[model samples]
Target: MSMTSILLTILGIAIFVVGLLFSIAWHELGHLSTAKLFGIRVPQYMVGFGPTIWSRKKGDTEYGIKAIPAGGYIRMIGMFPPGADGRVEARSTSPWRSMIEDARSAAFEELEEGDEKRLFYTRKPWKRVIVMFAGPFMNLILAVAIFLGVAMTFGFQTQTTDVAGVQKCVISQSEKRETCKESDPVSPAQAAGLKVGDKIVAFNGQKIDEWSVLSDRIRDTIGPATITVQRDGQEKTLHAVLKKNAVLKKDSDGEVIPGKYVSAGYLGFAAQTEIVPLSFGDSVVRMGDMIENGVDSIIALPSKIPALWDAAFSDGERAADSPVGVVGAARIGGEVMNLDVPAQNQVAMMLFVLATFNLSLFLFNMLPLLPLDGGHIAGALWEALRRNVARIFKRPDPGPFDVAKLMPVAYVVAGVFICFTLLVLVADVVNPVKIS
Candidate 1:
């Protein structure tokens, strides 16, 4: 790499790190602000983890930045309910019981004269749920805002009806080559005199305004068909008998899968594409697709671990869609910056990367597992359900749920996360994904 390229890479990584810190701060801000609003005492609001880089005490809350840029948190008082005896439970011989008590003790360690009423667990279940939900909600809001901003301003890359290239002859997709041989049969489009730059307006009397629509119709039509094209300010219809030929198969997402071919009706022209601005409705549809794909990707994560492990430790090729960690994302950010594109396009791509990260955070943290924001929200909701049931049955209220009792489970979850993070880091260093 050249000196300029290396320097640009460093700058991009730095920019991404800064954006990450800001996102963490934004997430914690949601927790901190909501806790304060609900009369809960927030003793600390820290972005990142490990040793503090800078801190300032204001009112009762100590705000600070930490060394690590991975994650952040807000220390809300009484996050867990007391034991059967109180926050101070009787000593238990079972290791699991001990783990539960230790968690409860830590929650109330900073007890002060007026802190009793300001405890988080003292709040109503609904309020507690809101507090826990706020952090992920903030990330969701940021993701949506960023997506909408980019979609409305920069637009999307889309294929148009204009023909970009015309094939000289039919080449089977199984051949895996774009070059045409002299012995190959003439393509239907070439035989019909379809030329480059012709804007397709209709197919078999059906109006065609979109390339996808035209592509589908062509794929389904086997025999003779009329193709209407708007060329040189005039509309003209061309006739040809479409041939059944082998073509590369595309996934549900319209992306061609490599080395996968199927026999289909063939057209012999490539559609041109441009970055076109989309309407609000179109943007919403785009977001919906992105979100659906994102969810599917997350759900399929466990299945990809073996591939990820092989890529990190062996000569296995790393799949392009493998899960990425902080290090991997930072490297991708650098790659994006070094892309040979317009400055504004680079900025738009960076924003999109950040937005996608935020969206992932929102989705991941909403899982009903301990230590994540979603876990706490689930606890509060369960508590609400129990109390409501009691009210209906004329039984004594169950009071606040003892979230601390799940400390052991949370610890296990955190350990797994840390191990996964380390594995990802190693993979990122050894066999990182490249955009090119």
Candidate 2:
């Protein structure tokens, strides 16, 4: 890498880290604000984990920053109630019972006489649910806003039916050759007298507007076809017999995967791309598509672990769709900044990346697992259900469901997450994904 490239890479990583910190702060702000709104005592609101680097006491809350920049949390007092008798000082012989009692004791360790009313567990189940849901909801809102802003205001790169370049000769995708050989045949587009800057008006009696539609049609049709073009404000027609040729297939991102090829009708032309601003409705639809894709990617993550392991340790090529860690994403951001596109395009791409990251955060945290926001929400819902069931049967109140009882399960979940994160980190460091 050149010095300029190295500097851009560092700058990109710095910007991404800053954005991550802001996102963590934003997520924690939701929890803190909601807890305060519900009269719950929040002792400390810290961004990131580990030892505190900076802190300030304001009223009942001590806000601070931590040394680790991975994630953050807020400490809410009375997250779990004491035993059924409302007494924290208790002991049990059974290991599981001991675990439950220990968790209950620590929850109210700082309990005061007047703090009973301000306890989180003392609130209504719905209020507790809201408090837990608020953090992920904030991230969702941020993702939506960033996506809409980038799609509607900054626009996206779109391919048009206009021709940018016409290949001179046919080249097989498997050959991996850029230059044409002596025996290579002239491309159908070149033989048909197609020129750069020609706007394809129609293809095989069908009106052509979008490049994707036209390209698909051209790829599917291998016989003779009439291509109508508008060149220099004058309409013209060209006849060419499309040839069945080996062509590289591209993914949704328009990147060609190695070892993948499809025999399609060759047009031998590249489409011109432009930054096209989408309408509000279009932007919303596109955002929905992006969200769906993100969900799919998350669902498919576990299935990619084997491939990730292979890439990290063995001599295996990293798939383009491999899961990327923060380091990989930062490297991608750096590469995007150095792309030859306009500055606005780079900014928009970076924003899209951050937006997707936020979206991932929202989804990941919403999993109905322990230590996540969704886990607390699930606990609150379960508590609500239990109380309602008890009331229906005219039985005694079950009281707050002690989520702290699940501490052991939460530890397991955290361990799994740490292992997965380390795997991704090793893959990123060893065989990182590239934009090119």
Candidate 3:
């Protein structure tokens, strides 16, 4: 492969990792900060999984870096199963009290003493809910800011007619025989009553110097369009609809399938596009709308996950057109980087995808299943409610997080996520989505 291609691939992978790490860290920070604000005793703040490679003591919390790069966690006292590491137990006055003071107990055991430091459990219901929800909220805000900044800096690409002194339309030359045929269709020409033989033209009541000028006008006008072209010996104005056409892709077997989409007006003919400048305010508004749409789409994805998985694994026509994994996302990022557009535009497009991605993660993590953010949120909420109900009856809080009760479901959910990730990885490699 060429050096440029290699460079792009490497860059894409690096960017993907950086973005993922940053996003994950930001998410955990949300939880850490909120827990601290509530006066909860968080002894260990870790990024990623596996063994700790480095650590630093910061007040009551021991912040550390881990060996694994997948995900991170916050170690709040009295939460989860008792650790044999003696981090909490050794510090306790009595062995029995140490067992009771374990990290996991924070979620289940009602505080008999030291209630002041365990403020997460003591806070009002709304405060607790907000803390649980803050992580996803931070992600959403990050997405919006990234998108808006990228848009303002680069603006958006549109298939409009704002021509430069470049080849918009060129006469095809033949070397073999004396004759050559035009394979590309002219949508605008046909719509404007220009025949196969008619070539010279003026557009939008202005003299057309090149095809670029014509392209600019069409892009600027996406709704109703009017084109003035020379036909035979006279000029005429033809009313047309400038609806964006979907660019189709073919699979390895040469079958057309839905793929990366672009906005191109269908004037009943095929033509190249030109770049058009957008106002800063307009770009920002578009970016905001895009972020809103992304959030809406993410909120709707979970209900569709089962169907999507079925389509990918079953004998359905749409099975091949499934979601992608890390490899696929990197490939896509590389392709976007290779585009003949400004860096800002490229970043904007990537940010758009990332926004939707983060939003998807935010919603997905909220599901009340094992190993996901949603599971933790659900566990916390359930414990809170259970305690409140027991208090009304004048009973004591529950004792511990029953691993047996939760393990079965957690194992199943973890299996499903792993399987899905592998399946999507295979699909991404086999049927990579190519942007036209």
Candidate 4:
């Protein structure tokens, strides 16, 4: 690769890493801030996952970095399995006393009884839930901020759905001209009996304003179809058969809404539109709408996971599009950067994709399961309810989340996550998603 190409490639990967870290840190910070606000003890605030790279005690919390770049988290005392054995001195101790200080010294403290310091359970259940949910909410806010910042800096382009022009191959000429004037009579469009300046009236009887509509219709139709067009003030029917293009990587949107893929087609055409900038208010609203749509789509994606996963893994023509890892993201990013459009515009498109990626992270973590934010939320909620019901029955309050009972589930979840990551890595290695 050329120096500039190498630079862009490195730059893309670097930006992606930085972006993921920034996004993840901001998410964890939200949880930390809320927990502190509610007077809950957060013993550790770490960025990244896995083993700690660096750590130090800072007042009530230990701040550190972990080896895993996937995400970051805050460890609050009471938030884990609710029934930790540490009890407040039943005899009488000031609520103002630090729970961490006491837990450090108390040898008899049980894991299920709540710890006074840094324990998440001592705080109100509602507060605990808020802390867990805040991470995803923070992510949504970050996306909005990034989108708005980009929009404000460069007026958002107003892309039209209209076909202003078309791309057709032609021989280079010596004379300047306003439009294509072909001397050759046997070009593809000409051989297909298509003429320059021909206005496309319809494809498969569907009205075509933009090339995208025609492209999509043609892909769906697949075979020779009657294409009606107005050329030289005459309506002509061209028997056109759409050719199949390579199946590229599938997009996440396809998992939510059926039939979301946009395959390549050699229609021998290109088009451009008048760029328009969105108003600041409109841009903000549009960004919000994007988030809303993202949430709804994520909620609906589970039903299609079986089909989507099948497509992703099956060793068939469609499997060619299944990308497995960070390499795939880089390959795709490089291709996007090399689009015929402006580089800044390409970056903007990448940012939009990143926004969707962030949105997926938010929604996926919100599902109630072990290890994810949603899982913690579910665990906390269940603990709170159990405690409340026990209080109503005039019985002893149950302990925090039972680690012994949950260990099996945790192992299962961890195994699945690892397997999926490995599968994706393999797929990325073997069938890396690259753009042409």
Q: Which candidate number would show the highest lDDT if scored against the true structure?
A: 1
**What number of clashing residue pairs does each candidate have, in the order they appear?**
1, 0, 22, 32
Name the lDDT of candidate 1. Answer: 0.89
Candidate 2: the clashing residue pairs are none
lDDT tens per residue, model 2, 146-179: 9999989988888899999998999987887789
Q: In angstroms, how far off is 247's CA in candidate 2? A: 5.4
Report, for every candidate in turn, its global Cα lDDT versus the true structure.
Answer: 0.89, 0.88, 0.59, 0.62
Query: For model 4, how does the per-residue alpha-carbon lDDT over 1-436 read when each residue is reduced to its tens digit?
Result: 7888777767776677677777788888999999888877677788898899899997778888888777787776544332235443233264323333343333223333344554565566677789889999888777776677667666554423333544344332222232555652222334455555566777777777755466566546644666677766787877665444432323433222233334443343433445455678978777877777767765654453443355456753323323334556655666576567787777776786566557667877887876678876887788789989999998897756442235446557878777766666655555555654
lDDT per residue (tens digit) for residues 102-168 in model 1 = 8888888788999989999999988988898899889988888899889989987899999999988
C-alpha TM-scores of all predictions: 0.95, 0.89, 0.62, 0.62
Q: Any runs in candidate 4 off by more than 4 Å, and if so which?
A: 50-57, 81-115, 151-162, 165-275, 279-327, 334-341, 384-404
lDDT score at residue 416, model 1, on the 0-100 scale:
87
lDDT of 3 by residue, 177-257 (tens): 223247533344344454443333555566665554564555455656666655567766667656554434333332334
**Could you tell me how far off, in angstroms, the CA of residue 45 lies in candidate 3 after the best superposition?**
2.1
Report the candidate with higher TM-score, 2 versus 3: 2
TM-score of 4: 0.62
Which order, best to worst by TM-score?
1, 2, 4, 3
